[model samples]
Target: MGSGTPSFLGLLCALLTLRPGSGFYLPGLAPVSFCPAGSSSSDCQVNIQLFVNRLDSIESVLPYEYDFFDFCKDDQEKRPSENLGQVLFGERIETSPYKFSFMKTETCAKVCTKSYDVSKQEERTKLEFLKKGMQLNYQHHWIVDNMPVTWCYTVEDNQKYCNPGFPIGCYVDGNGHPKDACVINVSFNEKNTFYVFNHVDITITYHSGEGEGWTGARLVARLYLLGVLKKVPFQYLWDYILVSMPHTNIQWFSIMNSLVIVLFLSGMVAMIMLRTLHKDIARYNQVDQEEAQEESGWKQVHGDVFRPPRNGMVLSVFLGQGAQIFIMTFITLFLACLGFLSPANRGALMTCAVVLWVLLGTPAGYVSARMYKTFGGEKWKTNVLLTALLCPGIIFADFFVMNLILWVEGSSAAIPFGTLVAVLALWFGISVPLTFVGAYFGFKKQAIEHPVRTNQIPRQIPEQSFFTKPLPGIIMGGILPFGCIFIQLFFILNSIWSHQMYYMFGFLFLVFIILVITCSEATVLLCYFHLCAEDYHWWWRSFLTSSFTAFYLLVYAVHYFFSKLQIIGAASTILYFGYTMIMVLIFFLFTGTIGFFACFWFVSKIYSVVKVD
Candidate 1:
């Protein structure tokens, strides 16, 4: 088996000849220009290189190196350096043997060939493995200009679907059923055989280097195979994909729908705060009506609502974790909206979030310590320790379990021991110490002052109605927030489970804000009702209320698994849910903390403004 010389294999089309010395920057995918490195722009000939990325299947969580399929190999293969996020994602990108010259155009070129005799066991085994890859429907991922080379085809209803990767091959089953790609030609009609794609006709579209605001030559590469001349993608989901005509209208409609819901919730919250609450405060503050007024409504619970919640230590820990997740999510989505984490910078989003979470230990510790102190707890050491270790420990443990599975399965998604050690070092060395520094400062500062003082004896709580019960209220609180993002969640799930590209960061950021408002208002609404009913245990209730959104997320995930996904085998199923639980936990903390702080502020403001004597 060896790479063959480039030879025409299909219909010839337009041939492009870029200037020999034209300089072009291709971010993350290949060279900065069509010239050798360190050469002046005018002094070099074209040096275009095509890179091959890891082959993956939607049927499995694992992705493999380009060389795993044994097609073509660079005589001296070179791999670009990968960042931590890329490594974790199993992005095994390497130089391909397919070479291009500036003045040349190749049509349907043969890249490599492998001839095998069934009598040779080693070659037979290799052939069998390649067939297995076809059976599993693994796709080849080619890249140019830091963008995936797209293979576009017409799906049902005459709509064009551009896939970022193309199938390695197609297989015809014993029953004479053919996979989608096998229908390209009658030559592939033989049953029980695997037909491989040995040739590709690549069309490269480019923005001239001299274009205004151009940092480099921007290129989009597409492969037109057989007679299927599908509409090519200008970029592999250029992040501008959603802003296209039809997509733009649908996305804006979704945004408007969500905005209406958010505005309605905000209006309700504002009405409660500005109108009803004002009347309640005014009537209560009447010179002689204080005592009677204090015996009813939310005002009655002021004395005990501020009391330390049960399981104060654990609650504080969760709050710390939530704070960390919230801040990390905010900054990540914000950066993505600013185009700093565009698809052009592969793996930058995860890297930025991880770095932000690691660096945000100070705020986590400060919030946890301050809250724990406000709860009147004296176990300062234990509080800080839990704040630093508890949530991260659980996540790491889950991740370790998942990694073990990946390791046993020989998946590249498995984290190498050295990388795991580096992560642990980041946690213990940087994050933990920052947590300690924050705790020290938090302890030195005064504990947060409550507007109203707690009585020496706890106030007797009244029985709650079904709707206002702890379980019911928490469960209900998650619904509205989840509603705000469920549409967005569908796109996110498609990106993860279905291998679709998702780059609508501005839309996501808007949904994030709406989710925040929904969570805050829903929790506040419930907290007020609970208080009015004279159930003063609001601390944990507020946290759990918003936290239950994660439960809804879990439910939706389960629904998606059954309805939307075609994943099979126990390992893939477990892997999917295992990863999902991690997401759910992080979301739980993020939302719960938002609700907790919002309710806390509401309680404080209401209590502070009225005379509590």
Candidate 2:
């Protein structure tokens, strides 16, 4: 192990060195100033440029590029300083028409005017679309110095809410009800007409050098400007999530908690296999006449232990999908851990996952076909087709239904018809054929060899006690696995719902390894106990045992929704649970497959080793 350590480190360094930005770096900025377009004033050097991202509404899933809104365009090509994650997430930040100089105090200054002639048909159409986006509560995400320009407002209880994005403009209804943001100014009172916000009052605040040791000024405030077009830009954290936590406390806490659970379970399993099982094997090997009648435990049931399970076709299909998912997840997380899929690169994580899943159909098919054949299944075509279609079909149907809801609600989150077609093409055109190829190869391969001969008659399993019952054992099996992940799950949930940045892939990878270990050990320990109680039916039980962890995950998510989230609305609630169900199903298959294989190996090894006449 010691000799291999240096070689492993050298290889890791080489891989990371070959990949650009595959190592951690702190975010730093060099201050620059801007004066009037041609002015040479040294005091007014701080110039800020606005960048635009896709315009999205809460009611829809489709996001349009900045150009689609017909907003102010930049004169020159200047891209913002973005990280790998930001780029991969489709954040097309570029120079904008709006410019500002560093200001010491909060003073509203006019930035620019966006006058447009509505007489032209093209201009009118663009204006109408922009107004419709505002009517539907579409938000504009702006970035300055890599920080979100937040819109701050007072809500109920006099508490202030800071939204990372601001509205384009507001529309008042014919019935005299002014929109929410429009109520802030009397200038936006035109009924049944789109009031364009053509002017913005900019406010900037900065910390002077005297207080924070900065040589000049540091922008520290998020501000908003309102007009007939109000623009408010409030500065928020850029990369403090990665650097500024309470200093490794959360990571250590999560690690310690998982370690405690893992150590406890590992101790239990170790005691059972090393001490109890060793003695059991020794006593059974003696085979004295006095103990011959008492051989009704696990040793007596060895003849039927290797029997192929009922509904083996479905089980094999799940195992194949599980294997595919396992490989994909491992590679994805490994890339992330190595910083290749760092949060700096926009959309890379999802893109990588989708591409990997598409390319992995062969493994799924191969594993499913091989396992099905081993189970004495004769229907190769059905097995392969089901493996290709079943789980993916279910997830797609759910996603399509959700998309329909988004369409009806007019939310920007809905998938476009073109994108949907492309997805289907990828699945049917590429994935299905690859799965068939894998299945063909899998079917051609010989079935796996068993260690012992099977009995002609299936042995009758004795009635199991409470401790050894399937339900109880499976329920207990999930506890440790869930414990290992619940901490990391919190951060993941935060990143998705709370819009917090998640950049700790190293910690996440560690947790994944722990989850695998916990699931395997817990399942194996329970499988041994069940077999000792003479219950030879373990195929389904072993799979379901660790898969039950997903149930705990669902429960935790529900608790999180009510306890941690302040999200209101039936649509949001429905969307949350709908997506969560998909995650739960995938996790169920992944963890359950790990447990099943571990138990399979353990049972095979122990039974094969004992001397059976």
Candidate 3:
């Protein structure tokens, strides 16, 4: 057959499948049954009308087709029923006989009707008529901006049906319903609703067969509610289902705005290195005694510049921890993008990150021990212990305090005491021992050799510009790299606190790559300028330059809590920033390590490449 013939045949098949009454029930004619009080059978019937609100192009954020039906006996129990047959094809299903009552009218009037007498057909018919008399008033209201919503449920015993999955809310049927009967509810109010677009269904089809035999199909549902109307009062519906508003996308422009300042600094550094310092260095050696004495800028820091940095052991530990965090983050994001730690798997992402970091303690120990030895630190044992405990201890202490609050509050977000103990076991039991092993190997190796020899006395740094001073320069260096990532951070925070599903791994990975590039380039460029300025104390400064972004992140966290968040009480604030500090500390180490290594390479290469007689 010709290509056109195949295409035509496929279209015909699709049309047949999609046509009304072609295996799928018509929209409005779908039957909804209600069981009257004390009646074992469903004695009432009503039609449920499905309507779509405003439509928008951003359906990926909120997708739910109008015709997708949810099944449950009450407002507290909702479950997707459209594909129930497929989901339970081979499963032995069991349901208790419970009275299912439905009321279509806005309000019920007491008619003093006797308890449903199922034995009498006349009484059953009369009850059915009364139920049918209740009219369902369809508002057909359109919501433009969808409200954020959450699905809450509980699982008990070993029964299968008791566990209702995602996009479905859950509640305990406290009215003496079967213990295995899972309850669910969907709300659209600003406080407790899943934001679904009103009127859109998107389907994606793929030709899976190679050479004309492949076929694949996927369907997405969407609903849009107006942002303003979401707040309007509605009696029958819940006021709010979610605790907070759905998080907005990361403001890339705001991040870019901050980055512009860093770029400007980079340009300034470039100008000094290429134009001003190059000539000054060349001219300094050739000048006579008087002119040499007047030598300024970075030219003064030739001696004592490369002296082993103070607290080298601590610095090494910091770098090691940072390296561990960086690798963990990279792997976690990669796996998440690949769909390993998706929303379907609760706690998977954190579990993955923790496992990976614990296993990778070898690298942290190796890097710290090697750096410490190079810094002339002879206490390998101290280095290894510090590497394993110092930073992690600080984080754990903070975490324990936060956990205490969570335990008191009884929030599901709290880590159980057993889990906390397990984390400690992972750290001290697994990670600590691994660090010692790595340190043994690192110390056995020779110290890393520097390309340039250190002068006995430090060169005096010349008076510097306001922007080039240590604090200002270091602070400025972090902005560019942080700018590349703050937008991505917003989404991450939302996924954590707002409980939104974050599946856009592609965008996140791109942002991660951008952050690494920005950190490296910005640090290298600044290190070169400092070296040319004769201020060779680029060791800690280089690390701090990029790491300072963590400070800004902490500031933002504070601002978010005070301004954007409705979280109350000191405990919440303390818990929020305490956990935030752990994040910042890890981030500090990661970014600092990136800058250090980049500067380390730049310093070694530039000095080694140039003939230093």
Candidate 4:
């Protein structure tokens, strides 16, 4: 096939697979190895191993790696596959003893049993931790063939809630309230003792070769571990796969909605540059000196427009952090879109982001120092320190506070002191040095040249209309950008709060692109209007205008919490808002920088083209 033909074919394939009611797996899906629960198949030699991830509680902020729990170890020292993100997230997936081959069956067989004597101090300590995990409702995350092993349970009447991992056990209180995974079984009613699940009934289901284009049986079912036989009749389900996958129609709607906003913004920006600005430039160049004196609009404020803002240091630092975050998010999302950071790889997403942010500190410091120098600041040390520490310190402080809460509650989600130290080391050792390097280079380079010269005396702006007022303009500027993202935001929130797997990063990546364009165009358009209105304070206005989108995100999150989430309790609420605040701040920086740069470019381009004496 020709190069163009392959590209066309790939596009066609993607479109076909994304159609509603289509096959669960994409076309040309690579076959994964699988064996029956008890039997081996010669067709595929890939050993099916159960890999365990960190144990986490929804109520907590810390997550413990699989090794933290003293459970059955792998027969060999072989560690399961993991990506960079997974490693950073402390996912320690090792091979499990329970192995299977294709087309096998075993009926309620005993995998292993643990009988711990409480008299022994070492064993008792381990048991105590295990019991604490049960009390805190920390869940196990098991993966087989890169697919999560789901534990399906009934909740909300007939609605079935299938968790990717089941708890090791549950604690029943004196009040007879079955907590965590114990609700699934009445036999777990022993008041104080941990009813550990010593055994599991494994079932493997696969699509046979009889399916249209498939050559061999492909595993379609997520491995499920039924802790107790008394819970329900022994039955395994593969039907949930079709029901659980995100609906393609909803994705298309989101894409279409974003496209409309993008197209509209594109048209408005094009009109301003091509028709409005073109004519203004032509008129200014042709008009006599007598006529020029009467024209006191954007042209009149040219000298003061590039005047440094009051808090140039702070703005430069924010822009630097924003640039770092922007690049990190873009690369992370793009990798996710390409399936490099798929949900199957535990913690890979966060791992990649953290690693990227650390490595990209150079750009962060460079942007800050360069902008600070442009603002005629000589304090390079202060500029670089703020660039490296300001935003990151705030985030770390918030995270540490959250972690402290988790520790106080004895939740498994708290980060260990060792891990915390390691994180600090990465930040200070790697990221801090990189920022200094970037700032050094940036300072060594000359400050950016503005197209128009600035006057020593600042211009006085006329009283603005309500629509052109700073607050109103900033508020209005964010609406379009927020509109483009609200749909995608729903899924992101669902992934975080509702514990749903997010795999539609392709859609997310597309939405991110749309958001950037929407933010840029919206800010540029608003900046143009303000400039034309004789407002020379476009510096801070442009940044605030796009950054206000974060406020809408906060609003929508509040709406999502009250409307969609069943989350209750002060701890959960506090943690939710705390994390949301961190996200909002980062987003503020990211979007604000985009708007600032866009407006800067627009101002420079327009001024350079017009005839200025």
Q: In TM-score terms, which candidate is top?
A: 1
Can you write out model 4's per-residue Cα lDDT over 306-341, one digit (the tens) per residue? 898878999999999999999999999988877777
Instruction: Go through the candidates in order and give the C-alpha RMSD of each one to the true structure.
Output: 4.3, 12.4, 16.5, 10.4
Off by over 4 Å in 2: 1-49, 54-140, 144-239, 245-247, 288-293
lDDT to native, each model: 0.76, 0.72, 0.53, 0.75
Query: What lDDT would candidate 2 get against the real structure?
Result: 0.72
lDDT score, residue 303, model 1? 76
Please give the range of 10 consecutive residues that has the lowest summed lDDT in model 2.
Answer: 9-18
Candidate 3, residues 525-589, lDDT tens digits: the string is 77766765667788899999999988888887777666655554566567667778888988899
Q: What are the per-residue Cα lDDT tens digits for candidate 2 across 261-280?
A: 88988999899889989888
Q: In candidate 1, which residue ranges exceed 4 Å CA deviation?
A: 1-45, 107-110, 119-121, 183-187, 209-247, 287-295
Model 1 per-residue lDDT tens digits across residues 411-507: 7678889989999999999999999988888888899998888888987887778987889898889988988888788888987777777777889
* TM-score for each predicted model, relative to the true structure: 0.90, 0.73, 0.60, 0.79
- Lowest summed-lDDT stretch of 10 residues in model 1? 1-10
Candidate 1 backbone collisions, by pair: 24-32
lDDT of residue 574 for candidate 1: 87
